[model samples]
Target: MTGGDEPAPARVQAKVGAAVLAGIGPRGAEGTDGARPHSDGGAGARSRSEETVDVRFPFEGTVGLWELLDDMAAAPRLVVGDERVRAFLVDVGRRLRAPEVARRHPELASLGFFLRRSELERAAGPLPGAAGSLPGAAGSLPGAAGSLPGAAGVGGAGEFVRVPRGLVFHVAPANVDTVFVYSWALSALMGNRNVVRLSARAGGTAQAILTIMRDALDDADPVVARTQRIVSYGHPRPGARRIPVEPPHKQLEHASPGHHASSDHHQGEHSGKPPRTSPVTHPEPVAPADAGSGGAAGPTAVLSAACDLRVIWGGDRTVNEIRRHPLAPHARDLTFPDRSSFAVIRARAWLEATPATRETVADGFAIDAYWFDQAACSSPGTVFWVGSPIECAMARDGFAACLAEAVARRGWTVDTAMAVEKRVAAYGLAADGVADAVEFHGNVLAQVILTSPGAAPRRWLGTGTFAHARIGSLDELADVVRRKDQTLTHFGFDRDELAGLARALGGRGVDRIVPIGNALGFHRVWDGVDLPAELSRVITVQ
Candidate 1:
């Protein structure tokens, strides 16, 4: 929703130069276009059924890799003048999103939020500042001088690491479709030519995003050429379907030891079983040279002279897989878990607040929940209260009423209600004694639990549930903050209490503690440090 009466363009480019760096290509001449060039011995060539689309790379052969990278480094400067491209991109995002259709299908909504142009641009815009700052004091490096903002020239030396011309980048993750856009943009910004392996499930969104980038680049000013020329293809294997791995503490439930033990035993039995005395069983020893060369036979080695960067955004299994590769030590892995966060209110604030203030706080909670059905990390999965039992009860009632109203306004249906019931039933069985406290409202639910100040730090104020919201006391709030499982905890209190809680929680390992409603705002700095400083490589020429 645009905040003003004035008619603003439905879509505004969030970051002007950054998208070019992300490898979005220029809009091609009007017509269907073929794939770009690749150097991996035509490995990109693959057949696709009309009904089932398969992403294909444009280039073929080893030489194509270097050529593509060179092309990308030069792409930001190429200018194409096409007005249709932006509209086409919006249409692509809309079609791929199909928000209206998605709203009717409850199951699909759980995956994540389908953001509007304003939201996407808002998120994408801040990245450029991060993207432009390289680490290692590379900011002043000769070639790096002009790459970032406020550089002497229009375009400074590229700010990111320059992957020597022939490197191949392996991208693994599916949760955030726009993630690749960021990755490719980083590569382009760094002046590296890259080939992206997209998650299979993200094919549709990837196609749309890539198509838009390509069209936008076709008309980009030559100054932006250094940031284009990236290729994307969906990896055919289903290995990319894994959930993102959060830190161990954030895992949904503790992993079963039996699972690991059984796997180990199975491996041990296979390893310890005496060589079968039978000739048939002993006849299959392969030569070491043959094993080495044979395994390499499927695809030609396409290594660049420099180290390769394998970016992974998946769960434990995927992380382990990435770790197994010889280059794993050099890879950069960022994890995003299926996390649910929440807000906490100081009981006094609720009791002392005017009717309007109470309504404002409740409204904030409702807005957070409705944003993406409370499935996003930004959504408040629970609320903790620090007040008298009576106040807690009142707050609980107010929150529930607001949640129900919000759910009704969104038009939840029988099927959605049934799905919530099934989820509750399953959670009730898991939670057993704690199930009585859980409350459901159509597709949304709240679980209120009371705990004295002295409860064990590990004790949860509420049981586990998707999009679950909980309310508890401040003392109980401290306990939850101390737990390893909690990723985000927002404290709603006046300045003094906020500072005190921040200090206490800081000591206990809380990642972030912000005001209740402002928790959803974008954070340029994380962990009290600038993210750009941590993520970038700085080079100085002087």
Candidate 2:
């Protein structure tokens, strides 16, 4: 989903060293249901005693939960930006870009473009924060397949060596299905073995994506399936009781049912030992206390305690709910919380734009607003016009007309429930004296005239409902911007003007300030945080 108050939110080869670390067989073979065998050689088939979990992508059908995690941990480790993984993702992107798929799911097309080799490489290249290294920087190591061509190694003090953060657990948002792909893809690109949790109600776009990925996996190296997984399970009700954990012994048992008790320093970097020749063996699977109940041993809890990182999406409520499930001491979270956005247009610019250009802008605005039903955190909920009162009123009227036409042209409509919701919200604002006028164009669009710029509503107001207010200058909005404000999409503004507004805000709010059409464009740096930098950790190797 394009980021509002509430937003919904591959493959590798095997080396002997990797094989040993991964505890898998040398040859690639099929497992039950046509899925590839587990990294534990062919044990993947025999281990399927219970099919409780749904493996949605790369493979489908239920599998024994423990078997899945064991395979993930045992899979051959990948250097950041491993070529095999890159190739697999690129293949999926190619499939997504197919005209038929794009026509059906425009969002998927955007995702396809984001997954392009060029874009991936660029993101995997030099990143913010780290003194020297970035995700995919493993290429700088000796004998590693170059992750980034022409990238340099750590040179001196202040330089660092970057490596994958190990198993990453992603909790994807329900409303925006494709979001999980982006979160998991980047983490995987950085060589992190991933387990993504999709909503049980994931939409068709997500299903289509899973199919593309599974198809791409067919020809990918066996390591791909061994390392990555997409699973969907029922979320335990809120306030579910937490599992009680015992203190760890020398070997820490992950708080998952059937998880093997293993030493902490499994990675070569920590162990400082040569890779073992034979696959690492494990003890028999033991069910945790409260295994079947929504307690500590539940899938979410198990994943939380087992992962090195947890990427959370949804909003404040989801973040808080997941936080109840404690993470391993070494694991941490990267959260995307509730945020709202607004649009800004210069009255002069709106009036001066060519009819075609104005139409195009309106169409783009419709996309930003309607793509996710304006429930995404990035969806613009209000419009700020800069001009005299008379000019602002004229521009508002003209823009409304164009926007309505654009919405109709795009066939975007709000159902009766949403339409009624918009009316209630709009009328409530008017009754409160915050909005002087409320207008609706059929069931597709609604406009509310705010009493003042400060009166802009931050909460969602149903799809296509936009609050309008005028300001004398762009700087005037700085006073109204709050920490919860995220994206500020605009038109008829020069770089200097936009930059000035951002500077004026001085990081108080509005992390992203882009042109209206690009409001929903996903980037490596989101919410002012460099994702590539955040996903990977740096070892200060002076």
Candidate 3:
């Protein structure tokens, strides 16, 4: 039987190369699921069984430190002023978003990736002008660096840190793809030749992005050379995944499933899992001893000491966990937690009695419920008032109706909605007391639990993407702000009342208070003082 002409060996090699370049591994290999095979492979039952090898480029120990610094210095200037380079970087970012790339590497969506692109774009762009500069283009950096064409600047430049040759970075945190990027990018940016021991789960994005960048830069370009030697590998040994016990918050997301299971099994086993042999390094570890002799070392010190800078982003749990570490005494880190954010209403003072006020209030409430699907800390978790009880109650009703309608129309599914409903239903079945009323629609649920004039900061209600809101007397709302757990509190009050509320919360250790929706967009300096400080060092050129 004459078989259809078989492809020549050269054609097969070319096909194999294309598949490999596309990030497709051999069939039956881990991570190959969702991968598309090359067209040449065409329903063939007899394709060659190829073994995949991870690409590695080692950093030589003999490279001189001064040579490294020279290379490092070139990166900032090349990246900052060059439009071509910025576009190239964006191209790399787009490549990361490709399905073939994203499925093979999940870190494209990481904060690290966001930070890398942000920092790279910022470096390529103009530096920020001094504070209080004029309104127009007179400010050197775009009103906001890396902002889409007309957006305002997010914050000032991130501090740049240079790592000398021969040092290594032990990157932790698989959940956050960008954490790896921060470490890897710093090593590349600073001209430090280094190794990145990838978190087993999320190294693909980091690996792919680095590969693309390394391939794109010219050999003679200092930035390219500095970044070229960086390498990524899983923990050399399988059992090496140990994170030091610092703040419980720092370890919360990275906590091992084994550790969690044990915690459940043993109930009181405070000593869950021993630190993995891997020396769990982060941009911020423990803060320095000098910040304060007591209390946990802030986020900045810990992260700065490890690499050059650390970039942290998440909720209150992350911030609190880092704060609770014993190393909190020695590490400096930065944190961007959901402090307080709010929505504003600029209607006329007399509008509270008019229909326009109801429309405005409804718009604000709808924003609070649906914006960013409520995951953003900036989404108003609470509301404030200036009008009489009648006005406030009317606003609340309008807000509730708007929110319910939005939920129904959009079919948004919330995480805690179902659980709350079940809990409320169970309570009704078992007890004689009046249960806190909760509303549910699919996965979106809203619950209103009455409290004494001021009970604990209202437990933010909602399941997945919903929020728990409280309608309280202004005095009672102020009292809620004083509680230790109320972070990122946004208030919607008259402009005059804002400063007073800010000062009141500031005294109680609250971090930020802003017009609600604006909370998610600002990138303030020393906001949390974790990553930026941790990843950078002060160099006084004598």
The top-ranked prediction according to lDDT is: 2
Q: What is the lDDT of residue 518 in candidate 3?
A: 37
Report the lDDT of model 1 for residue 539.
Answer: 46
Query: Candidate 1 — which residues are off by over 4 angstroms?
Result: 1-173, 176-196, 203-211, 221-308, 328-332, 336-340, 351-367, 370-373, 412-414, 417-431, 446-476, 482-491, 516-521, 526-531, 540-542
- After superposition, the stretches of candidate 3 with alpha carbons farther than 4 Å from their true spots are 1-331, 335-380, 384-386, 408-411, 414-436, 456-478, 482-496, 522-535
Candidate order by lDDT, decreasing, is 2, 1, 3
Model 1: per-residue lDDT, tens digit, 196-262?
5555455333444444343333344333323222332222434322222322111213333231111
TM-score for all predictions? 0.53, 0.77, 0.46
Q: How many backbone clashes does candidate 1 have?
A: 64
Q: Which of candidates 1 and 3 reaches a greater lDDT? A: 1
lDDT of 3 by residue, 316-368 (tens): 55445434322111333444554443333322232434555554444444444
For model 1, give the 10-residue run with minimal summed lDDT: 275-284
lDDT of each: 0.37, 0.69, 0.36
Better of 2 and 3 by lDDT: 2
Writing each residue's lDDT as its tens digit, candidate 2 over 472-529 gives 9999998999999999999999999888888999889999998888877888778887
Would you list the clashing residue pairs of candidate 2? Answer: 3-376, 3-377, 3-378, 3-379, 4-376, 4-377, 4-378, 9-173, 22-74, 24-39
